[model samples]
Every structure is written in C-alpha cells, then in structure tokens.
Target: MDTTQLLKGVLDLAVLAVLKDEDGYGYDILRRLRTAGLDEVGDASVYGTLRRLFQAGLLNTYVVPSEEGPHRKYYGLNAAGRDQLNRAGKTWRNFASTMDALLDERGVAA
Candidate 1:
C-alpha cells in the first residue's frame, strides 16, 4: 500500500498527539514526527495540518522570537484539541483491533 495515503488519513491525529505533551514550532513538530517513526511525513503536510487545526479551533498559536534566524510560531493544543485526541484515539484503537482480528483469522503472519 502507498503509505502516503495512509499518512494523510492519520496525520491530523499524529500531529495532535505530538502536541499533547508540549507546544512546538513547525520544524520542531516535523522533527518530532520523523523521530517517532513517521519518516514519510512531508514538511508541507505538517505545516498544512497545523494551519487546518488552528483554524478548526483545536490549537492555539503564538510566536516565539529566536536569536538564530526567524520568529518561530508555536502550536499547542487547547481543550477541544485534547478532547478530539481522546475520541480519535479510541476510534483508531477500535479500527486497528478489528483489522488485526481479520488478518489473524485469514492466517496472515505477524
């Protein structure tokens, strides 16, 4: 399967999950996602997701001045974001569990 399509479906959740613990700038968020095994996630996708989430009222943003280069716009989850994360997480777990069972019944190897 082309993982890019799969990534598209879950990128929102993944980004939200990463921001759950702390706020981060764009590059920082991208780095964290890659570090977490989502190496295929693209720069544009992360940035766009951030924009969409913020517009959706799921995230709060602010700029932090940096001495190195430019001001970094940081993104953090608000209450609605955390609530969505909890709900999406449960949905993902249930779907994954169902898929796992189907695969096992069909004798697919782990």
Candidate 2:
C-alpha cells in the first residue's frame, strides 16, 4: 500500500496528537513524527499541514528566539484543536477496529 496516501488522510490528526502534550516548531514536529515511525512523512507536507491548521484556527503559534540561526515559530493546540484531536482519535479507533475485523474475517495475517 502507498502509505503516503494514508498519511495524507491522517496527517492532521497525527500532527494534532503529537502536539497535544507539547508544542513544537515545524522541523521539530516533523522530527517527532518521523521518530514516532512515520519516516515517509515529507517536510513540505508537514509544514503545509501546520500552516493550514493555523489558518483554520485549530492551532496557536508563537515565536521563540533561537541562538542557532533564527526565531522558531512554535505551534500548540488550542481548545478547538484539542476538541478536534479527541473526536478524530475516536473516529480513527473505530475505523481501525472495523478494518481489523474485516481483515480477520478474510483470514489476512497481521
């Protein structure tokens, strides 16, 4: 399966989930996603997602200066973002369970 397509569908949810407990900048968020096993996630895609989420008012952003090169714009979940994350998480779990059961019935191996 082409996981990129899968990633496209769930990227928003994944991003929101990662930021639920902590805030991070673009590169940091991308790194966290990759470290969490989403190695195929593209930097551009993650950055774009962040922009869209911010524009949609689902995220809050603030700048923090960095000595390395430039100021970093960090993103964190607002109340709307947290609400979205919770709803999406439940939807994902139910969909996954349905798929798992369907595959099991077909005798597909995990």
Candidate 3:
C-alpha cells in the first residue's frame, strides 16, 4: 500500500490518538508520529489537520512560550474530541474486522 495515501485517510485518527496520551505542539506531534512509525506523515499535512480539527471544535489549542524559539501552539483533545475518537475507533475496528474476514475467505478460496 502507498503509506502516504493510507496516512491521509487515518491522519485524523492518528492525531487524536496521540493527543489522548498528552497534549503536544505541532512539531512535537509530528515527531511523535514519525517516532511511532509514521515516517511518511508530511509537515504540511499534519499542520493542516491540526487546523481543521481545531476549527471543527474537536481540539483545543493553547500557546506556550519556548525557551529556544518562538511560542508553540499546543493541541489537546476536548470533550467533543474524545467522543469523536471513541466513535471513530469503534467504526475503524468494525471496518477492519470486516475486511479481515473477507481477506481470510479469499485466502481459503485461493
């Protein structure tokens, strides 16, 4: 699979999942995603996702002063975000399981 394409589909979920652990600024979130094996996640895409999620009211942002550079805008999940994550996670699980079953059936036929 083209990882970039796959990442694009799940970027929102991935971002929300990361924030579930702790709040992070844009660059920090990008670093965490890369470290977590999403090396193909682009800077622009992540930033854009942050902005969209914030505007959608799924995330809350706050600015924090940086010692070495400009202030960073940190993102954290709010109540609505948690609800969305839960719903999305359940949907993903169901979809994945259905796909798995189909693939398994195909393998058996093959």
C-alpha local distance difference test of each model: 0.97, 0.97, 0.94
How would you encode candidate 1's per-residue C-alpha lDDT over 1-110 as one tens digit per residue?
Answer: 68999899999999999999999999999999999999999999999999999999999999999999999999999999999999999999999999999999999999
The digit string of per-residue lDDT tens for model 3 on 15-45 reads: 9999997999999999999999999999999
Instruction: Show where candidate 1 strays beyond 4 Å.
Output: none
Candidate 3: residue 25 Cα off by (Å): 0.2
Cand. 2 TM to true fold: 0.98
Total backbone collisions for each predicted model: 0, 0, 0
Better of 2 and 3 by TM-score: 2
**Model 3, global lDDT:** 0.94
Model 3 alpha-carbon miss at residue 44, Å: 0.3
Q: Ranking by TM-score, best first?
A: 2, 1, 3
lDDT of 2 by residue, 2-99 (tens): 89899999999999999999999999999999999999999999999999999999999999999999999999999999999999999999999999
Candidate 3: stretches off by over 4 Å: 108-110
Which residue ranges in model 2 land beyond 4 Å of their true spot? none
